[model samples]
Target chain A: MAKKAFNPDIDAPEYKGKYSPYDIIKEGTIAVVVVALLTVVLAVLFSSPDEKAVTIKSWSNATPMDFAATAMTELDGSSGTATYGPPYNNAATGQQVGPLTLAKWMGINVNVNTANDFVVAPLSTLADQPALTSALTTFASASSSRRANWEANYSKGLSSGSFSNGVLQVAAANAGPLPEMLGALTAMARSGALDQALVTQKGFYTTDYTKPLLFMADGSFLANKAQVQHLSGDQWGMMNETGSYPGQAWLWLYTMWYQVPPFSTSWGANADALVWAFMMLLTLLLALTPWIPGLRSIPRKVKVYRLIWREHYKNM
Target chain B: MTTEIDRQWTTRLRKRVVETLPPDKLLPDTQPAYVASWIYVFGVTTLAALAIVILTGCVLAMKGPLWWHLSGTGHFVNSLHLWSVEIFFFAMVIHLWGKFFMAAWRGGRQLTWITGVVLFLTSVGAGFTGYVSQTNYDSQWISTQAKDGINATGGGAFFNVLNLGQMLMWHIVLLPLAAVALTAVHVIYVRIKGVVPPFEEGK
Candidate 1:
């Protein structure tokens, strides 16, 4: 195919107008220096938030019962990760946009088995202890009915506020080996080994934090901390900075969807999917504003350009 | 039909480069007096903020996230990186609005406009990745929160926000480099195009 001629008139419009000597280097240098000073002054006046990272160890230590109960939820396949279909598991239906099953189409790529990944596997390393080993054996070998009964009984005990001294003080009946498992898991978590255990991957480096993070999300501990910082979904959290600081204000358009209408109130509203789709559509709209009939006309309709280059348009 | 000289990649590229950005066009010491508008200053300010962000990011990269958490100087540098980014986005938005009203995309400078818009989009991704890489509670909350949206769009398979190493590399290496390169191209186009002839008297 032959290329079109590069017309100087169209490609590079000739400039025949007033000119001013502009020192690009000097202007750039001044801007940089001014910005650097501003950054330094802001940094000195208001230091960045250094809130320590939340670890499984801290979560388990501070609130063992929540950690233990959350573990039980993971084991029974009732936790967020357990039921979070697609890219993880299929316990629950994946998100959709109208008839389009967006998440299910992506499929389960991360492959998280909440029962094994979140609980059993992490506890397997501690099998040297007779109680834990026996508990694991009992839990693993038990029939589905028996395991379910045990979990139900333990969960009931938990609801009754039977926990005493980080040990769930459940009545012996129907509890089976659940107490042993929960006790051992709590101990492991408090000892800070749970953090290491959760991240223990196939390779020498254990950087992928999917397992640990999923486990955290299953519990209210992390969520509560976020709420304290005003970083919750309903709080326009995605754009908020920690504490009283202003967050990524540019995200308002994206986060605004979460605060209103069908997204906030609809039972089937996959907020994430809906928001992502909306933003993408909006971005494309903005990018094509020049081509879109009404949007393209907005610049001329507003006439703000006259104010911007008032000096140039003065003769009009 | 192609000669060896014409077929050479460097020769073709050089010719195009020089033709498009001749000496004066590439580095002009003078600009149209119509560029006097205060709105023009925001673009330069945005670039200035980006420079600070990159410099502070480099320092943070050298010492790692842990050092930034513990050392006072590291904290200050990290803060600088954060604030610079805040300013970068802030100024860029203003510049974007200003140019939009001016119909800066007029003439054959559509590529220039497109590049600037794309640069802003990439910077948003870069900023989000930076937040996720902070290794603080904020990062934890944000990444886990963000993963849902990304995954819903089928981006989780590759762009796993929970993966610290992945997000870190993107923040420090990939996104920044893409943004910087795009910014360079955008600025070159601006220079070559000679800052859209201010909307004339009648048309």
Candidate 2:
């Protein structure tokens, strides 16, 4: 019984011409051996990367000023993760792909209040500090606009601030209690208490580091490390791994869009949604190419299959 | 008991399965002579590498992140897993490229092509999750970076990349299951359809 062929214009007729000896089980066994040996050799030559996760303690201890500066941004609600709407909060309008704003439509699910999660709550965890406790209360008592003013004033003081013996020396005028509060918070970050305190999930399995990563991302410390490792988005980081280790090279086409015109320039803000949309469209086309007229004809027009079937054609 | 077995659903399913892919076609002593190219071997190569990936992954899973980071043998196993994944995708892509040129979708094999596409996409996803589940600096950077794209597409509501437990579970379990299932379906399609006939020139 012969089967009906697909579209006559493009699809080749069912092959009934020739047969030859082929031991599939033997072929498969050889392949397994060959591939196993290849991977083992590659692994031995170039092992994987495993740089340890950065803790808040390391960040503070190594660069106390960077931690303090980042803490100030978190307190003032001016950091990247603080304003990273949708999954985090409704800080800004979520991403839009032309008419569709999918991020906004889904709404906030992670519910990260950067000020409390990154700063105040960590300070609140300290065992017993009278001045820190009083500063928290004073800051909590102030109005939103007043707090903004105090934050601005402290930010001004940070420009000329100095630290020695784990104490920040920011000028304390209209800054209100921020000097006292940040002093305590910086000390907490250094003690590694801030890292644990930020893990506020009320569960025994508190392995999710969403809160801490968000806080870390808001600071330049992590980004600095990423730059050194050649993992920044603009550097085609999607296809990169730390050091010389091979990355997700399979993501080449997906990540290449970031380096091109609109993604690199005009549409930077909406590039994520658009690039995703574009890749999806391309994938759909690739999947449905058999049914597509011009695309299905490419194999015939290109004649690459001739090379693939050279021996058969040679006999013919 | 013989009569009961003859009337069983299991018997009917067995008949149907054998009918679809008989022993001869499933493990044939011969394929078409046109399947002589080196390009044809990558499909099996890919399958082999995928097996290595799973085996190494099982070893890594047994010990968990701490051991993989601190212990030397753990690092070697982790390396095997990573390199196997690299080879898996490498060979898979080559297979896809060869199939595309040969138009393996001809002769009612469109579903076969689609399955390969799905497998490729799923494998890429599995690779992505694996990167994010390392519980290392790579995980930290990749998760934070990938979250935006996921969030922008409104996928973050369910798939929170920042959550290590969630990402690790998906990496080790969910995505691998999907990829394996898709691979099974893809291979079954190949078996049922019989390896696609070579592109007949001047058809």
Candidate 3:
């Protein structure tokens, strides 16, 4: 028949005895003031936008040959994004990860043929030029190794090549139908018509990786001329530069992981897997901290929370 | 005699129960043993940063996507938004790590821990959406590239990166709402349960 007594320990000290509601309001007011001050300080100092003009028209005009070379290089699987697996393009079955079962479960979703999409498709629009058209058709039909050999030869030739009055001339041995095809592409680029070719796609127009990757990769050309004036991977952080503007510096943590040798030199897919694994480990550590022996002891070890409630503890 | 005995027994039982209660339990006298100093402000600092993000995000949404390119005021507002986001994630990461090391989720507060993890995931989603809505050439590229990953994983059917309209809607409305909702629930639970008393005190 006896009633249970309410335990006072269950009540917060701030709610007890002579403490007024104003005490809570006072703490809240201080917090608000601190936040407002910080926000204003950040807004004033870093307010300038990083906006710089970067359009396809401007870029193609500035570096026509470079653009053409890039387009051609992509056609030969030497472009940085050419063989980027999974998200950008589907890897060949042999190049795919995991056993047959897992690979099949995921499947090859983002199917892309860099040579076809980045080169042949665009050149198809320019098929009226019989000579250039024939070169593209021949290059497209050639074996991958033969194309690779040709590009390798051409790329090597460019190392010692010279330019005269906007004309790039390489050794006659390296000068083949590919160089002539590149000339037409360069002329098209200089006129700013290349943008149209780069973006124009067939089918439902669901996805266009060409423009974005091109926009990122072509700093030697026009679009990123102002923003990513520096073409090194370190300067642009392995992604597209957003005008002249600052970008996600927080990504430093992620990109820094790549700057090291093993990650930087590893195969593209393997590097991605490494980063993904690292993130997974971090997440798991965070989730399991409560049960982890050394981690669970940290609060008591640090005793920082005692300082957080010092005034209350002082009275006690 | 029976009525008197019953009444006496009830009175005795009540007194015994009162006496058995620990003195610290009877009075709110046991102080929190964790640090209660001004340096603990980082936790609240993070929450403040999230507040800035929400407020600036609201203003930007009211003006729409082209605002950053439309007027000087709009551009400044957009700058504020970008800075707020930078600060929010920065603070969130620090706060999350601090909590992790402090074992702040101990003593039957697993839900708080899980909710924090969910908030982190939601924030990343929000960040990705925000990046896409920038509408720059970079935004254009990131969206197209990110779609491949999303599509490959069968997430494209639900979350289409190329659909600017869909992305803008999620960035402004859906994802933010989910983030705020999750945060609110997390906060309420924390307040109700109160901070887990220092680990050693139980031992």
Candidate 4:
């Protein structure tokens, strides 16, 4: 077969009556300018980052007993996230399932023994202080039930408590060596010396103690309050901010899934697994949309693209 | 016989012209109309936001993560980068759903659709590593928590979340590269195929 002659003008039908390259460029430049201007306005007005930091010492000096009770509560299993199953610590009761079928496979891997990591370990560092060391040891050796009773009374007393001259005073009925022990712990935290104690064990240490460090931080009263302020976990949604600072408002969609029932109330690995599953489903749907029935036909139903290029269509 | 040969040549020429011209340049008889819609802007706007994110992110990487700790300008730049990411993901989600409603993946643009989906996933990974690199208390908590999840699902064996060194490498190197590459592929497909024409006129 012979080669056919090429005619650019004859083939380029779109250029017959449409806008030229320069015209398209001009329009595009305008669009870019408008977007850039809007971005600048938004940035200038909402220029804030969630960068607040709360240290152990800050809390120890400010809210002493809350710190002590937090330390003690970690020694108990009362901290909200203490028993949070899978990923953080291994508490079998913390695991969740739907009806049957491993519903979720992931389980606790962080494995934080709150009592040992938060309470006994930190106290061990202050062993040179005989009074604190002895009190911690006694508290450690006491029956679980006895310790629980004491903690319950102390925690209750805290509800009606007040701070005076840096000392936290509660009802005498809930008083004893516990308050003094707490005071010493508070001092240790304020001095910033407690971080090492909480992190490092008594003897030679080689293990990566990141888990213990996280546990201590999570179980800390200040950390809890900060998380609350930030609207973390179930109590709050993604839109709320801690203080006047802006948080991850972009996470509204991801966090919204958690607010609804079943997911909101689910426990342990199941909750995390469900979230992952929902995200996966969404991605897959977006990916395979061309093949899906109802979704694949929506472009025709709403026919607004015609309006965007209405002038061009009118001329055509 | 010569007239018949001329007609045959004319038919061949028309076929070649149709194949060589851009889809948008073809006559309405052969080119499908993309009946315009508001949803169309969502995808393009998302792409625009992502372009900003990549530009700002590159500047931030050049300055290094500690730049925020160094001076006021660096901190401002870091804040801008952070906000860019926040906006990028926000626009991305909107774009994803807009495409969903329009079923913009129909016709022969499946590759474009898949590339977009991959880009979204990679962006999430990039966002996560960005958080981890912050080295703040929130970073500390998310890293440890996410590590546990990753480990349970067997992702930990390869991606050690506890290794700040590894996390840093992934954040600055691996994930961003994947995101940019996937986004490029998505754009190429979109340009080559043009937008998928609207579904059949009535439904």
Index of the highest-DockQ prediction = 2
In model 4, residue pairs whose N, Cα or C atoms come closer than 3 Å (at least 3 residues apart or on different chains), thus clashing, are A86-A107, A86-A108, A304-B36, A304-B37, A305-B35, A305-B36, A305-B37, A306-B35, A306-B36
Worst 10 residues of 3 chain A by lDDT: A8-17
User: Model 2 chain A, poorest ten-residue lDDT window?
Assistant: A3-12
> What fraction of the correct interface contacts does each predicted structure contain?
0.68, 0.77, 0.17, 0.14
Q: What TM-score fits each model?
A: 0.94, 0.96, 0.69, 0.69
Per-residue alpha-carbon lDDT of candidate 3 for residues A1-316, written as tens digits (9 for 90 to 100) = 8954432222112233123122333454676567766666777876744344344555546655465567666766766556544334554322222332222345444455666765566667775788987787787687777777777777777556655576667664644567766666556666666666665575434334344344345335432443354423445443434544456655555556656767578545444445445655876776676667676566667776555445655565
Model 2 global lDDT (CA atoms, 0 to 1): 0.87
| Candidate 2 lDDT score at position A45 | 94
Worst 10 residues of 3 chain B by lDDT: B22-31
Best by lDDT: 2
Give lDDT tens digits, candidate 2, residues A194-267. 88888754554586899999888878888899999899998999999998988999888989998998987899
DockQ-better candidate, 1 vs 3 = 1
Candidate 2 docking class: medium
Q: Per-residue lDDT tens digits of candidate 3, residues B52-147?
A: 788888887788778778788877877777777777777777777666554667656777887888888788889888887776655655564455
List candidate 4 stretches off by more than 4 Å. A1-42, A93-104, A133-181, A196-236, A240-250, A262-276, A309-316, B1-48, B58-66, B90-102, B128-170, B198-203
Task: Return the TM-score for candidate 2, rounded to 2 decimals.
Answer: 0.96
Model 2 spans with C-alpha error above 4 angstroms? A1-10, B1-8
In model 1, where do residues sit more than 4 Å from their true spots? A1-15, B1-7
